[model samples]
Target: MPGPTDHGRVLVVDDEPQLLRALRINLRARGFQVATEATGAEALKAAARSAFDVIVLDLGLPDLDGLEVLAGLRGWTAVPVIVLSARTDSSDKVAALDAGADDYVTKPFGMEEFVARLRAAIRRGAASASPEPAIVKAGDVTIDLAGKRVTRAGEPVRLTPTEWGILDLLARNPGRLVGQRELLTSVWGPAYVGQSNYLRVYLASLRRKLEEDPSDPRHLLTEPGMGYRFEPS
Candidate 1:
C-alpha cells in the first residue's frame, strides 16, 4: 500500500513497450501511482478520466502526434507535463516548451537527472497551484464546490450525481465556454463523448433548480449547438 507520503499519480505516454514497462516499475518503486498509454488518443482519454499530479509525455506517438495531445490536454486542465523524446535538437525542445510543456528531457537520459527534473517540475506545479475559493455565488445559486452542495435563494437544493457533475465543471470555468465533448469526457468519461442528450436533460434540470427562470436562464447558459458556459453575476 502507498503510504501517506506517496509521491503522486502520474500518466506516462510513449510508444516503446520496454520504456513504458521500465518507467512503470521505476515510478512505482519511488512511491508514485503510474498509468501508461502508447497512443496519443488513449493518453488524452486517460487524462480526461483521472486527475494526475504530473504527466510524462513523449513527442513521438503511434496514433496522434504528441503536440496534438499536448494541445488537447491544455484545452481543459492545467496539469504539469514533462516531455520525453529522442529528438535532441534544440528546436524540438523549444517547440515542446512553447506548447505548454513544463519541462523537456531528451531520450536515453540518466534516471537520476530525470527523477530530479520530475521532482522539480512537480514542485513548480504545486507552488503555482493557487487557491480558488470553495464557495461560488451566481444569481440565486450558491455552489459549494468542496462540499458538493448547492442552494438557491438561501434554501438547499438537491442535485443528482450527474447533474452536480455538469454544474461543477461548468461553474469552475466561469465565463468560459466548455465544449459539449469536453464536458462529456470530463464528467461521463471518454465513452460518453457523443451522448449530448444526457447533457441536455441534466442541464435542463439544473437550470430549473438553480436559475431564476429556467426558460431564460441568466447564469447557466447554452451556446446554441456549441456548448455551455457558467456566468457568475
Candidate 2:
C-alpha cells in the first residue's frame, strides 16, 4: 500500500516477458501502481481504458513500433511517456521525442537512474497540475485542461498540434508568465529553444482562432521580450 505521497499509476509496455516482470515487481515494491502490456495494440487499448500517471514504453514491440504507439497515445491523452529502447541511434531518440515522448532511456539502463527519471517526470506533471476550476473560461473561449479541449463562442475551435501544446502549457499556469525558453523547450523540445520565431507564428495562429481580436489579443498576452501569459478571465 502506497502512502499519500507515493508515486502514482504506471503502465509498462514491452514485449520482453522477463523485463516486464522485473519492472512490475520493482515498480510495485516502490509504491507505484503497475500495469503491463506486451504488444503495442494491447498497450494502446490499455491506455484508452485506464488513466495512468506515467507510461514506460519499449520501442521494439511485436505488434507495432513503439513510436507508432506513442503517436496513437498522443492523439487523445497527454500522459507523460518515457521511452525505453535498445536503439542507441540519436535519430531514434529524436523520432520518439518528436512523436511526443517525455523522455528517452537507452537499454541496459540502471534502475536507480530510471527511477529518478520517472520521479522527475511525475514531479513535473504534479507541478503543472491545475489549481482549481479545471475548466477555465476566458472571454468566449472555454478551456477544459483535463479533457484537453478548447472551444470558442460555443463552438469547438480547431488548433494545430503545436498550437495546442503551447496553449496547454500556458493554460496550466493561468495568469503566470511562461518564459520563452521554457515554452520552446517544453513544447518543441530543447533543440528549439532558440526558435522564438516559431512561437510568434504559432501564437498568432492561436490568437486568430481563440481571441476575438487577433491584433490586440486579450487572453494570450505577450510580455514584450520576456514571455507569454494566459489570462483566464
Candidate 3:
C-alpha cells in the first residue's frame, strides 16, 4: 500500500464489516490512504500508533460509548473526527460535537453526501496547516487561518480546524451576515448547506477560542436563525 502523504490518511471505525468495507472503498477511491478498525479499542490503538488525517467514527461501537471514544481521542489528538450515528436526536448530535467530533452524519446517508462531508471535515482540518498570507485579528487574538495559529493577550490559543474554518470564513467577510446556507456551503461545500449542526459546533468552538465570554460573543456574533456575522472589534 502507498504510504500516507499530502493527500490524506483516514481511519474508518465501525463495528459492522459491511459499513467499514464500504467506507474503506469510498475513501480509497477518493485518494485517501485508508485504515480500518472494528472496535473502539482497536481504533484507539491505531490512532496511538499513527497520525491519521481524519477519522470517520461510528457512534454505536460494541465495546464503548462513542462519546467516550471521542473524548478519549480529544484528550490527545487534534485529528478531525466525523461521527456516524444511526440516532437522529438533536441532543445526541450536540453531545458528540461538544465532545470534540468535528462533524456528524446520520445513517442511511448517500455515499456522495458522505464523501462530501468527509472531504469537508478533512479540508477544514487541513486548511490551518496550509501555507497562506499573514495572520488577522479582532482584538488581542491573532488568527492565522492558513497557519492554524491563534494567540490572545500575547499568548497562543489553540483552535480546532473546524473552528478555524469558521473564523477564516468570517474574517474574510468581516461584518457581513454570512448566511447559514452560504457559510455551510462555503466552508463545507455545497452539499452541507442544510447541516446546521456543523455550524453550531464550529461556532461554539470559535467563540471559546476568541471570546472573553463565549455565551455573550463579541467577534463571533450569531445572527439568530439566519447565520453568523464576525464583527472584529
Best by TM-score: 3
By TM-score, the better pick of 1 and 2 is 2
The C-alpha stretches of model 1 lying farther than 4 A from their native spots are 1-4, 132-233
In model 2, residue pairs whose N, Cα or C atoms come closer than 3 Å (at least 3 residues apart or on different chains), thus clashing, are none
lDDT of 1 by residue, 1-233 (tens): 12477787889999999999999999889888999999999999999998888899999998888888998998888888999999988767655654567778988988879888887767656654657569989977899999999988889999999898999998786765666766888898979877889889999999888888899999999976557889998
lDDT ranking from best candidate downward: 2, 1, 3
TM-score each candidate.
0.55, 0.59, 0.60
lDDT (10s digit) by residue, model 2, range 1-233: 12475678899999999999999899888888999999999999999998888899999999899989997997788788899999999778756765667788999999989999998777755655535567889998999988888888889988878998999988877765666766898899879977889999999999999988999998999976656889987
Q: TM-score of the candidate numbered 3?
A: 0.60
What do the candidate models score in CA lDDT, each in turn?
Answer: 0.84, 0.85, 0.79
Worst 10 residues of 2 by lDDT: 124-133
Q: How many pairs in model 2 have backbone atoms within 3 A of each other, for residues 3 or more apart or on separate chains, i.e. clashes?
A: 0
Q: What is the lDDT of residue 34 in candidate 1?
A: 93
Q: List residue ranges in candidate 2 displaced over 4 A.
A: 1-5, 132-233
Model 1 lDDT on a 0 to 1 scale: 0.84
- Per-residue lDDT, model 1, residue 209, is 88
Clashes of each: 0, 0, 0
